[model samples]
Target: MSAVPILGVIEGFYGRPWTPAQRGRLFARMAAWGMNTFLYAPKDDRWHRQLWRDPYPEAEAEALRGLVEDACQHGLQFVYALAPGLDLDWADDGDRRALAEKFVHVQRLGVEHFSLLFDDIPYAVDRAAQAREQVSATHHVMDTLWPDGQAGLLLLCPTEYCGERAAPSVATSPYLKALGEGLRPGVEILWTGPQVVSTEISVQSVREVNEILRRPVMIWDNLHANDFTLHRVNLGPYAGRPLELRGLVAGLLSNPNNQLELNTPGLFSLTDYASGKSDWTPEASLDRALEVWLPAFNTSSIHRVSLDDLRLVSHLLYLPGGLGPQAVRVLDVARALVNPQTGAEEREALVRELRTVRHRVITVLRALEAGPNRDLLFDLHPYLVDVAEELQRLIVWASHRGEDDPEVFSYRGSLADRLMTLGWKT
Candidate 1:
């Protein structure tokens, strides 16, 4: 309902960057979802980060040019970002010139949007002095590349880009204040809310940052990012960001799960929220997303089990307290069946439902093993195997109620240990 906010995706994770083919696919998807921007800032790319002063090799440059053309054809802005803070010599003009030249090279490849990142670098004891130097160095590059403010779009991610890292506090931090005042008016700044992976981003928080920056802050939302832990995959829908947030900033760009397929639901849900869909709820949005997602794994005929259950038992692994509605339903049925007072007919019915759930999970697992999305299967494979084992143990325990079986106890303990490693509650 709110004017569609500037929605975009940033491939800014720390792990292996997405392949060129994968990136092309992402651009097509972003276009379909009405996303307008694509930021190229992968941390592992040496030319983008460590070798920040060097130009891209011809082969790589040609590939990037094709990607930029693809993005433009899809009506997406390809923002080429460079992380020069890792080893940039802020005091050296030659260093500044090299940085400017890199941008110029990218600009020649039809990239008009640019970003300079100074995140994840050591902080100086003289915070204000360092902040001024960083701003000055960035301005020098921007001015050289697009003199007199002719740059199409320029974004900066300051070293103290988030609330926790902003020494003292955002309002009182001399470093941030310097950035706000020293940076040119046309340059946009990127801020990750409160923390790198904030659970919630309130309007008041954005307002405070906006006041200090004297401009609408471009948000780098890490809601679905998983590079911090390989075991985790944040498939949850985009919540905690209110629709009113559209009015508070320049745009919202999410750093999503490393696995491209897993990011679809959250991305779609974000688009819906930004588009003012009044009926939007993370739960409902996830349901609609899975309706399309599950079938891709060739499990469309597996009946009576919902995607919520599938996620809880599988994809939602590696996060604490992550049981989905289906998993909960199975747990409830198991508990009821464990009661000695339960009638035989009711027990049989619960057993049938449990078996159906188990069967569907197996069907999904097999399909994944043989499907094109098998890499995703590999990521979720451990959780799937454990869930299947747990279900079989549960069914066996229920069938022989009140029996003291040492094997059952051993299996239960092993399952508990596995769940704990995956961040699930016992």
Candidate 2:
């Protein structure tokens, strides 16, 4: 009914969930940006996945109640997701009841939106049958908790939730076909484009999945998630999807980076995309995001953080397997610095450029430490440490060594640098 509705965030990453204060800040920001939904589905939240059948402790329940109330206050629809796929017995009536009761408890606490996620678990032996069973389970809960189909925005995240993960393919997967055939008329499916962290989601891919699902799928956007690569955090603008994509999907929700503080740029970028920035480009969104986000980097304006510094940092840590324009330029300079036949004058300039990058890393690190925003500093501390460490290695090579030493190539950080040498297994 709400046109191309449900632009939101799903706290569904596999790491420490955001703290209450952090969530409060997010709710406020989401409202300001006109995002309409918030899904609570953090994978490591034991109660959300591991302890799915158990009731939340009084304190936890009260905390969730307050969260839901606050979200509604800000005009954000709060969705509570139950990830019981880890050990669910589709055949068991007791398990079905447990799932329904779990929803009933939270429904009392004011969670109008609910979803059942059957993702990340082992594939069922009979995929088609399993698909049917999963849909039946969702329907059972719907029938038990809110008969007459009055439940708010219901969703399911199938085990094969993306094109890459689907057995054989999305077009031919019996699992998906069965899932589509069995889905209740109003229930929605959550899909993560082609890959778990797809760099691009084309129109054709969406059309294929939509054809199979028999409905417009809701996007569980993972462009900004960094949980898989702990040393990285993506501050890139949401790119890779066509602007016309909004018309193809039922909704789109970002399952972003675990570090809430680092998500400001990414979430804002998604908001602009979802809320209709008619002429959005990742580069432009990134520039706008940097301007808005740079203020947080400044502690007192004395140890100031310039947009240039943030832009550099973001470009370096832009996205998974992606290099920002500046990052690419820096690498090109580095390559030239190490080239054997490069003239001394040009080599000197290349080395200077690298030294400048390292210098900026130190400056940003110092400014971050000078923060009134310790949380942002804490979240970024690991990456800055890694960057600083690598910058040192790069500078050492560019300034002193023109030759590529085998020893120099093995400068992996953390325990890998110490323990895992060139041929440990061999």
What's the C-alpha lDDT at position 95 in model 1? Answer: 87
Give the alpha carbon lDDT tens digit for every residue of 1-426 in model 1: 435456889999999999887888788878887899989899998999988889999999998899899989989998999999988887787887898888889989989899999999999998999889988977887787777665588889999998999989999999889899898888889999988987778899999998988899998988788899765676667777776777888988988888876777778777766775656676776666566566656643433335655565444342222545555677788778777788989988887887777777776677677776666677667656766766666666666643545143544556646555352212
List RMSD in Å for every model shown: 4.6, 3.4
- The TM-score between candidate 2 and the true structure equals 0.93
What lDDT does model 2 reach?
Answer: 0.85
Tell me how far the alpha carbon of residue 270 in candidate 1 is from the true structure, in angstroms, after superposition: 1.0
What local lDDT does model 1 show for residue 368? Answer: 75
Error of 2 at 90 (Å): 1.9
Lowest summed lDDT window (length 10), candidate 1: 312-321
Model 2: per-residue lDDT, tens digit, 1-426? 223588999999988889888999999988887789998999988889999999899999999999999999999989999999989996888998899899999888888989999999999788999899898998887887678765588889999999999888999999999999998878989999999999999999999999998999999999999888776899888899988888999998999999998998898888877755667688888888888888888876668878888899888889874988888898788667666788888878877887788788777788889878899888888887777666656666556654444344554566856553343221
TM-score of each: 0.83, 0.93
State residue 14's C-alpha deviation in candidate 2, in Å. 0.9
